[model samples]
Structures are given as C-alpha cells and as structure tokens.
Target: MSELIHESVLDIFCKYATLRREEMTLETSLLAAGMDSLDAVEILFALEERFDITIPNPASVTEATVGDVVNLVSKLVAEKEASPSA
Candidate 1:
C-alpha cells in the first residue's frame, strides 16, 4: 500500500513539476523541482481527493521532499483506515 501511495504521489507531483519524472527522487526538493506555493496547494488538494484524507497542515507540503509527502500520505491513509467512519 505504501509503495502504491508513493507511486501515486509521485505521479501527482509530476503533473505540476517542471522536471521530468525520471529526474525526480525521494530526496529532491519540491521547490527546486519548479513547484511554488500555488502548486503546493494544488498538490495538497489532489492528495486529499485521491486518498480521501485531509491534510491538517498545508504549509509543510511546500518545503517537503517527495518522500516526505509519501510518508505523510501513508500515515494519513493508515489513520483513515483505522478510523471507525472509514
């Protein structure tokens, strides 16, 4: 599930990134990959819709790496799955 989330997150980032998908790595900085504040918000919105989870802190996404976002999404997904309403 985490691997699927990672791939999906990477795909989402690739949609807004100036860099090619092959050039992106987990360590790559989001800002350096041509993402701005607006892109970050869009990415967050996309993630929320894709995973059916809410991001409590939108600001952190702007400075995070691909791996960071994957981790966050994984955590959120797990939380959602664990919740009674899910």
Candidate 2:
C-alpha cells in the first residue's frame, strides 16, 4: 500500500505539478512547490480517477505535502478495498 501510494503521489506531482519525482519527498510542501488551488483540485480529481475512490470534499483537503496526500489516498484505497461492494 505504501509503495502504491508513493508511486501514485509521484505520478500526481509529476503530471499536475510538472515536477520530477526525484525532486519530491514525503515532506516536500505542495504550496512551497508552487501548487495553487486549481492544481490542488486537479490533483484531487486525478487521484480519484486513478484510485477509483471518491474523496468526498475537495475544499476540505488540508494536506500540506505530498506525504499527506499519500496518506489520505492510501486510507481511502484501503477502505474501498475492504468494502465488499468495492
């Protein structure tokens, strides 16, 4: 799960933020990297699409770094995987 989340986050940053995976770390701040509100929303949408999980509220996301997003996405994926209907 950790690896998948890590890869997914790398993909998100690479695609949306136009960042290289080598330039990112768990503590790398998205805002510090120049991620704006629209970038955040786009990343969220991309995450949902890639992981096939609903994030519920976009405005409610308080993640400050790539690690935070990774954690959230991992949790959501776990929950979805654990559900019988998923």
Candidate 3:
C-alpha cells in the first residue's frame, strides 16, 4: 500500500514538477524540483482526490520531500481505512 501511495504521489508530483520521474527520489525536495507554491497546493489537492483523504495541513507540502508526502498519504489512507465512516 505504501509503495502504491509512493508511486501515485510521485506521479502527481511529476505532473507539476519540471524534473522527470526518473530524477526524483525519496529525499528530493519538491521546491528544489521546480515546484512553486501553486504546485504545492495542486499536488495536495490531487493527493486528496486520489486517496479520498483530507490533508489537515497545507504548509507541510511546500517544504516537503517526496518521502514526506508519501508517508503522510500512507498514514491518511490507513486512518481512512480504519475509520467506521469509511
């Protein structure tokens, strides 16, 4: 599940980043990869829609590495799966 989340998040990032998917790594910084503030918001929204989960904080996205976003999405996915409402 985490791997799937990682791939999906990477795919979303690729849509907004100037760098190619092959050039990105878990430690790659989103901003350093050519993502601006608007890209951050768009990525967050994409993640939310793809995973059907809410990101409680938006600030984290701007300064995050690829791994950070992957981990966050994984956690949110797990929470949603565990929730009774879900």
As a whole number from 0 to 100, the lDDT of residue 53 in candidate 2 is 94
Candidate 2: lDDT over CA atoms?
0.79
Error of 3 at 52 (Å): 0.4
lDDT scores for all predictions? 0.90, 0.79, 0.90
lDDT of 1 by residue, 1-86 (tens): 99999899889999999999899999987897899889999999999999999999666666799988999899999999999999
Q: What's model 1's lDDT at 9?
A: 88
TM-score of 1: 0.94
Q: Across residues 9-85, which tens digit of lDDT does each residue of candidate 3 receive?
A: 98899999999999999999998889999899998899999999999967656679999999889999999999999
Q: Across residues 8-83, which tens digit of lDDT does each residue of candidate 2 receive?
A: 7788777666556788888877776667778888888888999999887754443478888888889999999999
Q: Is candidate 2 or candidate 3 better by lDDT?
A: 3
Error of 3 at 76 (Å): 0.4
Candidates 1 and 2, the one with greater TM-score: 1
Q: Give every collision pair in model 1.
A: none
Which numbered prediction scores highest in TM-score against the true structure?
3
Residue 24 of model 3 has an lDDT of 93
Model 3 poorest ten-residue lDDT run: 54-63
- For each candidate in turn, the TM-score is 0.94, 0.85, 0.94
Model 3: how far is 49 from its true place, Å?
0.5
User: Which residue pairs in candidate 2 collide?
Assistant: none
